[model samples]
Target: MNGDWLTRGRDGRLSVYQLSGEAVRCRAERAPGGPWTAPRQVGGDQRLHPFLALGQGADGYVHLVSWRPTVKGEAGLVHSTHFRPRLAALDWNPVGHPDKKGDRTGPPAVAVDAQGRAHVFVRNKAGGVSMLAQKEKGGWDPWRDLGGEDVHDGLAAVTGESGRIELYAAVPGGVLHWRQEEPGARPVRQEPLRAPVRPGTLYALATSADRTTLFHTGTEGELCAWRPGDKPVTLLDSAGHGPVSAVRCELDGHDCTLLAQRSASGRVAFAAYPTEQESAGAWWTESGPRLTVDARVCLATDEDGRVVAATLSPSTGQLLLTRRKDEPGLALEAWREV
Candidate 1:
């Protein structure tokens, strides 16, 4: 299976990682649409999934994690996820073993905190959340259990108002929140989200201004968001859109949220949610330029607040970068083929 993923480093370069069968291909640029470096392949086998999770550490290294799929006729195939995580510099040079023991039930998600520390979370073998923190220099702390039973799918994390990084998981009943308030907090605080959430990936964003928004794909596949202490709000009914994301941005000198989604038809779209004081909905809904694909899995915004995307091609089974035309608006730009 092929995978396509995008992330930004401290240097403001857009780093793209594409998985084709067993090889991982990488390319980076000072910025999206800039002169991309020559692509290079990292060794691996087809058993590995291409939908890798990526984050940039405060130390200036790119961190990635994806587990190998279970193979039939193997002793632990039914209970295996075999994770071999990697850490790379801005240049895409990797440092890690190709095979590590672990299991993951969903696509991984990662985030970097204010301290430049990299925090990664994934659903583990027991359908519970497992996390690993990258040390200042290199190496990862042993995967720690961030307990949650029946944790359905995707994982998300955000640096909270108090500068504490909180991780989220979707369980059958509601969204689960986990966090350690301080450096040596006793037990990781766990709480229930205000409302019921779908079993897909959970997305959370905490603005620097102290506003937090929680969004997810509902049981009916509709996009939903809820503010803390409030009822869940349905943003849009599903029409094959999956993998929702909200990134911190600026509009008219105020902090905003930039959202993106991939429709089942392979068309990727974007919308803008200005400050809560400004509106209750997207300023311009799904009006951005779109990229056609076999499946769009990853959508991210870089340090410059520009949205970037990637997708899988059913025909060629390769991952491709989705770029936008140099137009004025965030979602209004037309797509430019690279």
Candidate 2:
């Protein structure tokens, strides 16, 4: 499962780099077979932080959201836009004003359903979560609340097999998940399914192939998995290194989980576990090579089942991408600085 990396260049321009053969090669424009020009800057301020870029639907539209911090360090929405291939000469624009008076919104998570409708999830400083969607008719819908009235830490959105939408979040006390039949159904229902008993913050949450099982990691350095008919299991306890920073998709033809965690000394380590076992049932096994980089790592998987691990160099702060070898076991490609 090879994937590409996208980040803002030193000059404030969006840059694309392809991860292949354990090396990252810069693509002059976007990824090959992608738009010729990289995504345009959404806001005037080049100092804005680049959160994440979401792929467009079959209609050839890509979506992105980013923010700029205020004088006091509060993030404010700067721009959110939909890129259409037809509008090659166009630039991104800010979406609706979804944040409240003093609340700031986080980077948006984009999801494109089977119908080619775009669904975006945004988190606010007020602990609220909102969902915005673009219908097939080419109209932007109103922002709808999904977090209920609680404070949420992080938000994630994914499209299921039947094009159903699943939204997950880490709230103050536990994790919450909601699903809908369509892009804009009132979330159908919301439930707090997993509670991290240890002392730590929940950093990330991901689902298995069936989307029936959910996995999460907390600040206490423990990894947990939850399923419909089973109790929440602790797959791995970090001891004290801190929570798992990143998790990739399920490996091809295996019921296993792959995750990247920050150690006590801040080094990043990769671990894999069987998907069907409980956290306590199956001993969390560490697979692949350990990366001793300075900064935290992020995990991305391509459609073909390749995994790309990325982190910033602690010494120079330059981004690094490592491609794991395409083997049955955990074999990693060489690490290269992008």
Candidate 3:
């Protein structure tokens, strides 16, 4: 239940998905805070991977993509959609392996374009990347190979303010990027960007209409930022050990960006700064009881425009929720199990 597991729908209702055993479970918030529905099983139990990728389209539907063992014991992607906050999720739809050999692939990352097509990306068996996207008319287009070798497993994909999809993957010396020149078009690979990022820590934030900033833990654990053609900027001195969850929202009428990550000691750490103003500075503040087991924190803006963060209790396996208080400077309410 980490890495983009929480999604807020256009209706203002928030949906959180997590892997419980081999089955996917979903919890819904009527609005931002209280009276969240009890966890409901998404699909039948299967040999599904532990990862789940959640993406919301402009149409208000939340699209999910996950890997599950298919024929020959190789993993294939499965797709599902929750049309509305309180509605039952659609049945799992199978997206076969990228190649005919049923090659084993890594967990899939998804982004739905303005045209409502879901683009799924995964690290292929050959150490490169492959993508399978939905077609406008109805069905899905065949899997297309988006070439990149020496990349890591976790793929970060997001739709920009202009409705184009952009992707970032961490490689050895730097990061690889791809962006759609136009909305609903194939994402073309851009020049290899420079950043000594630790793989699996890459996250993308659409700070403005035409701009997306990539954030990741540097090879030395520093939280770093890089937009196309710009030199890498250190957002925080230390971002801890995993992928950073970020969201841009209006904080007290001023635009701001919020970040959350798992601290090195396994506690949830948070930071805030003015959007696109990396030089303004940000400091990490640790909160919540340190997890007794491994877990990650996810950030999203609630219906009330307050920042909402959630994570699983590794010891009890219960969901914990917290929200930013109305007052100044990213103050969050106490963490309470929901």
The CA lDDT of each predicted structure is 0.55, 0.51, 0.81
lDDT per residue as tens, model 3, 150-257 = 878778898888878989988898889999997667789998887577888888888987999988888777888888878889876674777888999888788989
Candidate 2 collision pairs: 1-305, 1-306, 2-306, 56-61, 234-279, 235-279, 255-275
State each candidate's clash count: 2, 7, 0
Over 29-51, each residue of candidate 1 has an lDDT whose tens digit, in order, gives: 74544766665554333345545
Find the number of clashing residue pairs for candidate 2: 7
lDDT of 3 at 85: 70
Which residue runs of candidate 3 sit more than 4 Å off their true CA positions? 1-3, 44-47
Residue 172 error for model 2, in Å? Answer: 3.1
- lDDT tens readout by residue for model 2, 1-338: 00113433222223343322222223222442233353233323345544543533444344454444455645544333334322331233445545643435655666666677767777654567777777668777777776554545345555665566776666656767778855456565565665653322333333454455555665565667665446666676662343344444556566565667655554556776665544324333333334454345556554345666666443453555565677766677776655
The better-scoring model by lDDT among 2 and 3 is 3
Q: After superposition, how far is residue 254 of candidate 1 from its true place, in Å?
A: 3.7
Model 1 lDDT, residue 36, Cα: 66
lDDT order, best first, reads 3, 1, 2
Root-mean-square deviation of Cα positions for candidate 2 versus the true structure, in angstroms = 7.1
The segments of candidate 1 whose C-alpha lies over 4 angstroms from its true place after superposition are 1-4, 30-33, 42-51, 58-60, 68-107, 160-163, 183-187, 209-211, 264-266, 276-279, 283-293, 297-331
